[model samples]
Target: MSGPLRLIELRPSPNNIKVRLGLRLKGCEFETIPVALDDAERAEVLRLSGQPLTPVLLDGDLPVWDSAAILRHLDTIAPHEPIFFGRTRERIHEVERWERWARGVVYDTFTIVPGMAFRGAFDPAEVERANAEMRRHTARIEEALADRDYLLGDAPTAADLTLVPMVFSTMLTEEQAAASRIAAFLRQHFHLGEERDRTRAWVERLMAHWH
Candidate 1:
């Protein structure tokens, strides 16, 4: 094997989850390094990374931060089976569109809207708002998933990989009564496994080993 890709995983991070999922899908091995990003450690992280975020991948001397960037890096390293399944640029753009949607819209509402609207921080009010907002987002997501088994199409795309982590742990611990379809999809495909058979299995395996 080539030298292991070094990964620094920050806590309470869904973006990191997507990067980890990408690595798993590409069959790339990496050293997972847990980092703290919630407080004073954030400055340390920024100094070390020259950025202020998690899911940082250190490949030899090259450092790649951000989930989408990490996914692209992994794809280049192992090109045999691409994490992105589309053969056409249009299809790829479709996946990218949803990736951006999840990043900007869904996660934005679920993660910070609740707090920002009332408490000026991600607090109970934020959690409450997140639930209502997440429900609304989930309705749209459920509609998208109604005909296809996965979010993008019949097979899971980067869109699914991106959203799972953002919504998965939060929905379970913070909001237990999340929309049924989203929760069921995560449980069945990511947590429990049935509608899943590929990268989904890999994700379950990683959570077991990492946490």
Candidate 2:
């Protein structure tokens, strides 16, 4: 909090997107340094975070790795505009629960499936399984949003920021798809469909409001 924040990232990564959204939500002005999967960039990342991972946040001289950890750091630095809504103990736990689910369930599908597709190891059955898993997950999101505009309430919290980008990958616009092969792959394979009406609408609403 004492120095200008710096986010080391791969631009198209959903985890990186979550950190960016968290920073914006907290009204923090920061600089983003985009990195690639190359030897030089990997060494830089390892030096900064002790691991070669994108989305390493330099908070002053403190390097915080992992998207969730970075978001928690944001809340610590900017408590007034918390990523966890209300700043209550209960709300913190609730938001953390959602973050875990997002990382475990939603993030896994987006990462594994896309990694396979991008590697040219694509299998129709694998994609079908991933798509089915997505539908199941989105159905849960739909039910969660049944009585609220956002995941925890009317305002977007870390939970929403964490999940939205991963979900958005599945429903990317033509322009978004054209820009990123990973996005194109996700759009081609994962279909949210009309069944997840509320979840689909919620993703669109958050994209318009936040992005």
Candidate 3:
């Protein structure tokens, strides 16, 4: 608590972004140390967390691994502001559920598809499969947003933290990132239209936090 939290992460990692958003939502001060997902840096991460992964949070002498653990640790120490997991048990369960879904389904789709597409190293069938998976995950998100402002309710929670970064991943090109603002970007990339108006609005509202 004496100094800023040290967050070691990969710049484009959704997992890292989840922790970053959690910190921001709680109004915690932290500094980011970004490393490439290359051999040397991966080794360095292993040295720090005993795992070859990013988004490791250092709380003074203590090191926390993964976004889920980092957010829980932050709540334990920085208990004065927005509660990342929500105050109620049901809300907490819902938030955690969506967070896991984000990691497993949403993150996988966005990362696998774009990573393969941009690299151009995957077979055409693999590309199609990736896109189809992405669509399935996205439909789930759209349906979730149909009746609520946020994933859980009116307020943003850790679920938003987890999913938003995956949305960021879909902004593959520099032009896509720069030219299209949040709603437009979501619309274009997700192939959303009037049918997904609520989801589009939710994205725009979420963008207000950082953009």
Candidate 4:
């Protein structure tokens, strides 16, 4: 645990970006080992974490898979810094709910919808239907930010970290960064622009963790 931690991740994975941002926000120094989307890399991931997934964090020989688990582990490893999880029972439940929604519904849409549409693998009407679902999720987030700076309150939390990476600038490539339909959707719903939108401002605050 005294040694620097290692994270095996895919470059474009929102989940991986989430863990990286979480660690950076806590001022933790760690090495990132990128795993490409290939059979060999997946096998290596399985060997490391018993799962064919990126963003597997290793502390010595112990492998912790999944971003949320890694964040919780980091909190234990460094307790004096900013905490991502909640301190109270009700607050913890609230944080957990938003984290699940962000990862499951919101971020998952970004992961799947664009690629499916790009490949023309999905039916046109089906893509439209999927975009509608994405809109609903984004709308929920916008509504949540209507009254506060962060999702749960005025301060950043695990839920905010979980969701912010989905909209982070480096989450996508430069050519398609502002060109993707999902990117437009983010600008419309997430208010991801240079404007003074509170949620966008919150995202900027978290960006200080980069580098």
Best by TM-score: 2
Tell me which of candidates 2 and 4 scores higher on TM-score: 2
Q: How do the candidates rank by TM-score, highest first?
A: 2, 3, 4, 1
Cα lDDT over the full model 2:
0.80
Q: Compared with the true structure, what per-residue lDDT tens digits does model 1 show for residues 96-159?
A: 9988898899877655533342333335554556566766666666567656666766555678
What lDDT does each candidate get? 0.62, 0.80, 0.68, 0.69
Per-residue lDDT tens digits for candidate 3, residues 185-207, read: 33334433235566656666665
Using TM-score as the yardstick, the better of models 1 and 2 is 2
Q: Cα RMSD for candidate 2? A: 2.1
Clashes of each: 2, 0, 0, 0
Q: Tell me how far the alpha carbon of residue 208 in candidate 2 is from the true structure, in angstroms, after superposition.
A: 4.1
Off by over 4 Å in 3: 39-41, 117-120, 176-194, 207-211
Measured with C-alpha atoms, the lDDT of residue 160 in candidate 1 is: 78
Error of 2 at 202 (Å): 2.4
* Residue-level lDDT tens digits of model 4 in 88-140: 78888999999888878776665555565345464556555555665565566
Error of 1 at 179 (Å): 23
Per-candidate TM vs. native? 0.70, 0.89, 0.78, 0.76
Model 3 TM-score relative to the real fold: 0.78
Residue pairs with backbone atoms closer than 3 Å in model 2 (clashes) = none
lDDT of 2 by residue, 1-211 (tens): 7788999988777888778877876788988777974445487788877998879999888899988788778878887754554477899889889988998878778776788766978888878887888888888899999999889887878889889988888788788888766778777777777777788888888677344
